[model samples]
Target: MIFVPLPYVVALLLAILLIQMVRRSDGNKPNLFFAALIAVYALQSLVIGTRWGYDIVALLPVQAILAAIIPALAWLSFEGLRDGRSPRNRPLLLLHALPALMILAFVAFWPMPISLALIVIFLGYGSALTWLAWLGPNALGSSRLDGVGNAYRALQITAFAILGSGFIDVIISLDFAETGGTHSGGIVAIGNVLALLILGTSATVAGTSQPASEDDGSGNEIPSPVPSAEDARIAASLDELMQTRSLHRDVDLNLNRLARKMGLSTRQVSGAVNRVKAMSVSQYVNDFRVKEACRLLANTDDPITRIIFDAGF
Candidate 1:
């Protein structure tokens, strides 16, 4: 009978997910990093599968390398989704790689140290992800994603998957100790394969749900403003701009562009819209687009396709 490794099957699915991310990534750093994380997990599964399924002793060091890097990739990808900032701090990111570097250095001579290091990395990063999830949507405030509410749910699932990975490692370690380092490889492979499936799918869903949109603006925080004449004036000016120029029809309009057109700062625009409309700037903009769409739909004989485009939706 021809041998078929489960990891190979799972890794193949993950590879397909990675390719989808790349095709739809559109230069979003968060998505790209997420894809990289998925790639690492896929390779990790493949390595573990090969080492156990074929009993390849020489591949042990390679497995060690992939395992060591998993936590680092997890943390970095989480940061990417949280911050939604491109061109991240490269120097700091390089620091996360230290664990993997240490593993590569000691894998040949001191395998025990590598094993201990992986344990610490998994536990530490897993706890960190869990804590981040505990913070809820506020933790994802900096993200430019559209469906933050849904994304947060996906984030929680991803966190649990990482946390599960840590627990799996602990269980495997205990099994190794109990069996004199001869625990069942099938169990380890199955656990990791399931984990990669969950993590890869959750991360992909969360990352893709937040595609770049014109309404996302710069995603800079806006200070809340007291309702006052200045706020009303700014809001009125924005209203006039939208009405007179039909700027809402642009479909590419954002806070910065709207602010620039009105000769106001982005902060002022955001503040004014928030205080006057009692809603987010994106919401305020969408309201106008929705109204226009409604008008087009009711009064014109335009198809929905044309109406959506014409109404800036």
Candidate 2:
């Protein structure tokens, strides 16, 4: 309410924090996701701006708009596909349209009290969340999102938390209603704080927080490695190598040379391979080399040493 700019203050802080997060991220995907979050703030401003000295009644339509946007933002932030494309054939951009649709729904059902409108508002929001889980990245294979150690699990849990919150809110509202809005009086306030806390925590874990982790700018946090010209050449070479009768045959193949070819630092390449495949680069390479050797041995290879060398040992 304008009388007590708490909502505006909270929303403004979160909006700023999220924008900073986007700026700190080295990846475009995370940046895009956080941009959606910024839009949420813009939305809040749009609704509340009209009420300078008025009560929260002026903010109801704003909340109505937010109902759909909240869920949509959650989906975009956490559940984008492996390539960052939405699972929806149209790229799931449809999720962003939800806020408008919801606002329209409110107008179509106008003259309803803010309370009743909120009911339908939450209903649409909840449905969007469920749909995201059903058809978005949540339904995709877990292996992709859950990479290694607790990384994938962390992501999955956050995704679940977003969807779960909607249900929890429903139960809270029911209880609040049973006891007359008293219980829900400060509910929105509490929810706002908690939401930012959760998002901030996730941003920290996801490497979007600043002042940087390890607190060092000199080089504790490595730069993002992309496919340079040389790296692309190496990738292409590796692809061709994989097509051969023997590629993984080199059990002791030097990683330095591979990293050199790929235009990646040894640490960067190692981390990427390990995180993506859940195995050390050496072990992965060695295992593949052994498999190739075995295949040649069982099939029709001229000699074991030849097969070993051919396999990239």
Candidate 3:
């Protein structure tokens, strides 16, 4: 009988996933972080496959370290996707180092406390991901533009997938304790494979569909000059800004930028635009571009390509 390890299958799938993530990443911060997260997961699975399937225990410490880093990477990737920024701060990297350091210390000397701490890590990050998932489409920030609902849905699913992974960790930890060192590795291998498949697909979908970043250090919150009840006044100011400045001519314009230009909160801008324009911010912006395009097509002698660029279509 020829024996095939499930971990090998998992590793192979993850390798393919990594390649896709890399090809689709396009240097976007969220996508890059997501790719890194997938790479880490792949490395962890490779270690597990070698350890359990091949009985190689040399990389056990590496596996433990990878496990500690997974949650942090997952959270960071989600944050990058949400906020459209990925900080390269050294302190953040150092903070993530704490988990791996604790695991390494356990591997070297103190082994008893690490188990409980691992559970804490899992449940803690899982709760956070679950909360973000509960935020629904809003959690996607500016990425919640036209034709992007599917990507947002994929991200929500991925958040739940992360939460599921935390519960799986709890189950595995309990199994480890209850079995007195006789836990079935096959079950864990299967669970890891399934979870990785889900995460990889969701990450790819969400990452590739991400809108280009429109933030230019101008999205910082400023006090709303008008009260919430005065949405009409805000709407009027926004219209004046759009008409006078032709801000809609910028292809990368978003609600945040519009709000910043008008000195209003995103919520205020969104509400005003929604109530007054009777359409989404993206739709409202497109209306201006479409009108301009129609004008150019009807009256202009310029080439269609030049007219398209000029009209910001």
| RMSD for each of the candidates | 6.0, 14.4, 6.2
lDDT scores in order:
0.70, 0.50, 0.67
Better of 1 and 2 by TM-score: 1
Off by over 4 Å in 2: 1-6, 25-30, 41-54, 86-92, 95-100, 110-154, 208-313
The residue-level lDDT of candidate 1 at 124 comes to 86
| Model 3: how far residue 167 lies from native, Å | 1.3
| After superposition, candidate 1 runs with Cα above 4 Å error | 26-30, 88-90, 200-289, 296-303, 306-313
Query: Per-residue lDDT of 1-313 in model 1, one digit per residue for the tens?
Result: 9997888887888888778767765564335556677888788778877888898879989987888787777766656655445635555777887988888889867778666777777888878877877764445544432345445666677667767767777777787879955765867877866786676667566655343232222243333557899999999888888889988777545555666688876667767876787766666766787899999989999899999989876
Global CA lDDT computed for model 3: 0.67
lDDT string, candidate 2, 144-217, tens digits: 21122122333544555455556546655676579855555356556555555665565455552222222112
Candidate 1, which ten residues in sequence have the lowest lDDT sum?
211-220
Model 1 RMSD in angstroms: 6.0
- Top model by TM-score, which number? 3
Can you rank all candidates by lDDT, best first? 1, 3, 2
Question: Candidate 3 residues 89-119, lDDT tens each?
Answer: 4345567668778888898998777667776
Which of 1 and 2 is ahead in lDDT? 1
